[model samples]
Target: MPAPVQLYVYDLSNGLAKQLSLQLTGKQIDGIWHTSVVVFGKEIFYGQGISITSPGQSHHGRPLQAIDMGETALDEETFNEYLEEMRQVYTADKYHLLDNNCNSFTNDCMGFLTGGSIPSWIKDLPADFLSTPFGAALRPTIDNMFRGPAQGGSSAPSSAQPLASSLLQSVAQNATGVQGSTSSYLPTPAATPSPPLAASSSIAGPIQICSNTQHFNNLLSTHKAVIAFFTSHTCPPCRIIEPVFERLASEKASAGVAFAKIDLGSAYGGGQIASVYGVRVTPTFLFFMGGKKTHELKGADAGELKAQVDLLTYQAFPPHPHASLPLRATRSISLEPILFTQSVNFEAVRSRLFSFIDLSALSDERKKSIENSITSTIIPYLKNKADEREGKGKGVNTSISSGAVCEAWRIASKDLIDNLQVKDIFPLADLLRLTLLDNPVAQWCSTTAAASGTSPPHAILERVASALRNEQQIPKPVLLTTLRMAANMFTQTVLARTILVTRSNGHHTSLTTLAISCLLHDDSLVRTAAASLVFNMAAFYQAPRMEALRSGRRGEAEEEGDGEWEVELLSAVLEAIKMEESNEDVLHRLVASLAFLLHLSPFYETQLKPMLEVLEARSTLLAKLEGVEGGFTVSKKEARALLEEVGTKLCG
Candidate 1:
């Protein structure tokens, strides 16, 4: 059977409450009175905070009106839990004279118990009382008189609280027409205060008490995983789970999984945090990883709580088998040249490329000179060099060389960079794009060895990279084009090695970070380009390493940074797949990259399972794309098959 709910309202006076409002604020008002919700014959009330009192004794006089709020579907346990949550929010310290007084509490109670709020006229009374010029001017004095220390007591109820109480009691006694007895309804103070909740012992591991939202968020960010226990001092279930919570904290301390208990009864703003998470019960547990809430459990079931804590701890601190693996297995793989099969339209590209260049940014004669230098001089020079190299019976070198074409590239790059403005950057990028379309120059730049002791061909490409990095206000087209050029340079084995294998100042400027940064770019085209670049790098270089790690020679040097670079790359790919705007091509490439990275990497499988689970849950999308054709260069059906195959391998 549904629980019965009733709304009981009391009149402040026959009509004196209205007269007082008119005198103080020069505005007529309805009678002010106290209100409460009676649930299942028990008067469940929230004043400064939540309380329970006898039903018939609540109103000093007969209520002005008793409205049936209808029955509630909530069971006794659910109702009590909701009340406990309300107690946290309506704590004594949080009450205000005009903003969050008893009326507000009553409104909340009504909404929860009956799925309806009290009338707006009753709810907005306090605000109406304070809105007048005279009322506003007298507020400070009235506030001080009522809010100062209570006579013979250290604390005082705000003016609104006492005013409501005094008027209700006085009028109840004098008004002959009222129905009930005029007895005081104020709760008798307890003779002995309840003992403070025992603090969880440090021997069982320290349980941090988060006092505010910022503190809780900071803890989440600092720890790899966190278990937040929301407890209340007055709740029996919360107390019952305390010891078990502490025990698990102690057991998992060494694993770097943080344990925290929030006293919703005592901690300031604790209720606000609970509200943010939609927690409406004591002994609620929240599990967070990487600043996201991954799991939640409610109730005081110790066995279930312990099991969840164990699972979270295990995931937070997984065993590292890579520690025992060979250095050869973990080391980066060798780089290789990426050959393009698509036919190029050189004249069409050159024409469109020059059209976007900002001639106004350059002197007219200088612009003409620059155009002649790249097209008339640089292009012809590169073509001639490529022909000469081919005539000499030399195939492409394994390393980039600082030759005539390389020198000419450097000069042309410098000219573009010196005069380049935001508008001109796209044209310059397009120029680089056109240069790569010339197969001979592309092959020469990609494979030739650096002229002894000089900068490699890849180094010339850095001029463009540097310009993009340094210029903060670059247009999206320019940035996309620049990234494309860098990606194009990486197709060369030597350049790929330079970017991926070689460290600059002990830090790898990873293609993973670069590609991930652009994944969120406002322009879809930019995101597509970034996704394509990531796929190319991962497919060519990183994929083979995973395969070799599964079946190749072993070596030493077991100690290294936890594969953060690999994790970052994998995370980026997964994130791109999850994005709402990720097109079929982007998803295809991203999944392919993920498949390559997961191959034979047992450690990654454990770390990546959560994200993979998210993808698996979206089975509809996977099924839809299973036979749909279109990818970086393959059909969606092929990409889906590859993903499933890798997923099976990882599972095994």
Candidate 2:
């Protein structure tokens, strides 16, 4: 029978939002909604993590309304198992006020149970508040308020405790409950009631709690292999083998393998589960593969259980194709970005930049302003950075601070970059590129640009990209400097690399677009820098793919646009590979970039494989390896090997 699910909505503002919302936000929001899912005889809500009680018994007290949210086909046991899986996600520390609060959890549950969503008005209150001017001003304060005392120096909102006087009365009123225990009718949460079980984020270790047949069947269907331990509480042998089962689960439970425990005599549908599998004895272990029972053991034998589990795991996740090839040198290629570390005459670069400003067709006031900024702020900071790099002043206090450098660049980006003629932008860009090599400056610029604001944090990079795209014939120096700047962005921090590679939005200004444009440039120097840029981007994309292949699960942080970027990058590199001829260094970079983009790709069969076949990627790579006049020299051997591996292994 399908169970009815209701949405219990509460007003956390306790009636204050009705009076103040109109004056504060210029919108008439009735209440600050806190919601919970009441389903299968329990009221589940997320506050300091997930909590559960009988319907109408939570501290939030009788809901503003119990909305009929339709019914769920899932049995109680199946839903309980689903809630167990959700524990790792809806953790205490992950809770937030405006973003990921009680309403968010209930909406997720509502969708899962009924294939429907909560009312949009209830969920859109935060958006409404931020949409107004006064409310927008108070966003930082509101955000801090919910981050808790540990993080934001403010205590979390106090959840109202259930009144002591109502405890006996509430229990008496709800005597007939799910478990038919007097304690089940009480307002207090059940024992295993905490939502966020402090397990490692992805790998939940101990043997999973299995209380129903549907969820167990769901587990068997999803995993490559499953081990079900059927045991009885009265059996001494069952107790002896329980620790071994837990150890195996802790060691082997992953996306591919699942470990579950079903007590055959416990109160929660255990006898039904036992009867379904025909498990007539205590300590009976059943192994399933491809959703069929493969092996069954009846004893407290730890050795047999461990052996069977190991064999199934080994069969499920076979070794990767790359493991068979002798491509250790190819796979071990350094991922560090190729930097423009050649020391330059800083004084000469500074002098020429100022000279360009002096010679430019601008007002004297504007010229003086640029000169003062360069002299007073930019130059000193660059010198201090240079000194830090060369280890010149080890202990002495450098007068130019990081804050001053940031302020100087802030002015340069907002005031100077846009106003200057395209010809003069290069010198300023070149100077700024050198400063970006410093880790602090790079991290600040990368993270700030991701913030929501009117002013872009990386305005100078934006200006450089704009000039590169708009100009009909760019000077070689400007082009080379721009490519080098793009390549150098991969250094210092992962945030910078992620921002550069995964940030394309159909804009010519994207760093990915910039790299593709300069890839097959007429100048080999420009091509080399462009290749480096592509290599950096490819390496960033490939790192997680490699880890995913190893772990059999994708990370939570991976973006949806990754597949689109991969296809785009692979297409551009293949075109560049066919056109690349004379310079072995350029060819090496191009070949290496292709290898990183293709190796261990999760979408190889669906996306990359067909694309590779269409592009004749194999023949193209073979031409690079064999068609070389004398073949690659011994020093360039890794490049040849990498090309061969990509053609034969990855392209297939």
Candidate 3:
């Protein structure tokens, strides 16, 4: 069930800004708004980083008013995961007064929770204040008040007299802008303290604060490598190296290594955590691998610390198999999805499509309606989209609506497939191939699911595949155009990945049926397009394999079925390689597809290599290479090298 969300708005000036802002800045700013999101009985806000407490009980005290902001379908666990991602971007060091603040944080949370934004006045307060003459002049002074030594290159000025004298101090103190404590905008003592740790998961950027033994152990067990920093707030040396520790965490945490900080003096269980690890110093670093301490460094030495971190990460994740390969040409190949983005003559295409329909078996009424839709809606939209893509759009108001295009596609696809001849369907498929290049139309087609009255995502791709499979001999033009359309589906990566690997009503969809069939096509164009589609699929599975290699969790690929997909893709690719004789370009693409599928594959040892041995993949490739005419080109040389590397290194 969805939960109610509210925005807790506070007046950072304690209502004094309202009375004095007109005289001080000559701007009638109502209040210096500080906001927090209230949901699931927790008041979550960003201050010394993100904090969670009982509703209306954060250090800001009770909010002046709580604005109800609808509800969210997202559950707590999913929401927390979103917050974990945000922690990387919204670290304490990144906070700013007018730039990024508590209100901005609440606004972001509100959008995630309710698909809505906070009241504009609350979030726009800073901009409004900054636009004033006096406010503009004081921007640097105000920013310097909160800037720490690491950021400002000097000790932060005392908030006591930040503006030089009493009058300036009073105004500066009242107008501190947003969240963190500049000595002026100190947090009011809360009746109840905020939770010590927002989460135990390994998030990037900020140091992961561990408050208990179990929490610390959980971080260690989950990550392959962890660096625990023992520190205390009272120690000056801890402050000196804290920034270095944070910078390294940001750099290395994404690679699946965890960085934890345990404060020896704290109300939470940080002291207990330090005691368990026998840490008594202010800035001690302990490197743990597989939850066992391997190295330790006391005090701050930035160079040695970085060296140790690099050593630990290297020991943990190591390098991917492809890293050792010397295939220069293949390494330079771009993995971007092949999209058909030509600004084709929509009027000419529409006329050709009408002529094709006229020769088809469609009823007269259906023909008239379809032609009218092509003339009035889809053509205009495609034209506008083309103009926009070429930076020729006259203005925003002249743009055509995408909703009309989606509806027209539904009607045209149904009518054309149901009534037109298989050979004549190329025009319609060609039109859709062009239409799918438009981002709005592609996004809509990617996400729309089959419902009581709606068509499934990529229905046209499936329809085209069905024609190829059911017909005795599909038309070459139709097959080529359809294959191009299938390749274009990778424009939306999630849509292509999800739809291709999935079964609909218990049968193979276009991926296993259409792409696999066209893989060994007699026509090089059709086969090249099919190889592109297959490369997209291979790249999808290859991503998790790479992540698994980086994080020292190679077993995860098997558990998640990534290995199964690689084996299935490779079997078809190997068959294609055996039959493919000439065309270096097609062979190069096929070899690159193999690289994505076979490199770092978890099934390499158990399933993939055994299959390769049975098929004699190396001998087949060598035989193909032996037939080259004069000499090997750079592409063919790299292609053979890639194939050889796979056969010897991976399969051996």
Candidate 3's residue-wise lDDT over 247-363, tens digit each? 786556532467887777654356677777788787899999999999999998888888998898878866655646664444454656666566666677777778889988888
TM-score of each: 0.37, 0.62, 0.61
Model 2, which residues run further than 4 Å from truth? 1-244, 252-320, 352-373, 394-397, 421-423, 453-471, 497-509, 548-564, 613-616, 625-635
- Which residues of candidate 1, in runs, are more than 4 Å off? 1-369, 381-402, 434-476, 505-510, 520-525, 543-551, 556-562, 580-582, 601-636, 647-652
The 10 consecutive residues of candidate 3 with the worst lDDT sum are: 151-160
Per-model lDDT: 0.52, 0.63, 0.63
Q: Which pairs of residues collide in candidate 1?
A: 399-448, 399-449, 400-448, 400-449, 400-450, 401-448, 401-449, 402-451
RMSD of each: 25.3, 12.6, 14.7
Ranking by TM-score: 2, 3, 1
**How many clashes (backbone N, Cα, C below 3 Å) per candidate?**
8, 0, 0
- TM-score: the better of candidates 1 and 2: 2
After aligning candidate 2 to the native by TM-score, how far in Å is the CA of 621 from where it should be?
Answer: 3.6
Compose the digit string of candidate 2's lDDT tens values, residues 48-140.
Answer: 557788888876678899999899998998777767655655665445455456776676677668766778778666555544333333433
Which 10 consecutive residues of model 1 have the lowest summed lDDT?
552-561
Off by over 4 Å in 3: 1-206, 213-218, 236-244, 278-282, 286-308, 340-368, 380-403, 410-425, 449-457, 464-474, 492-509, 539-561, 600-606, 628-652
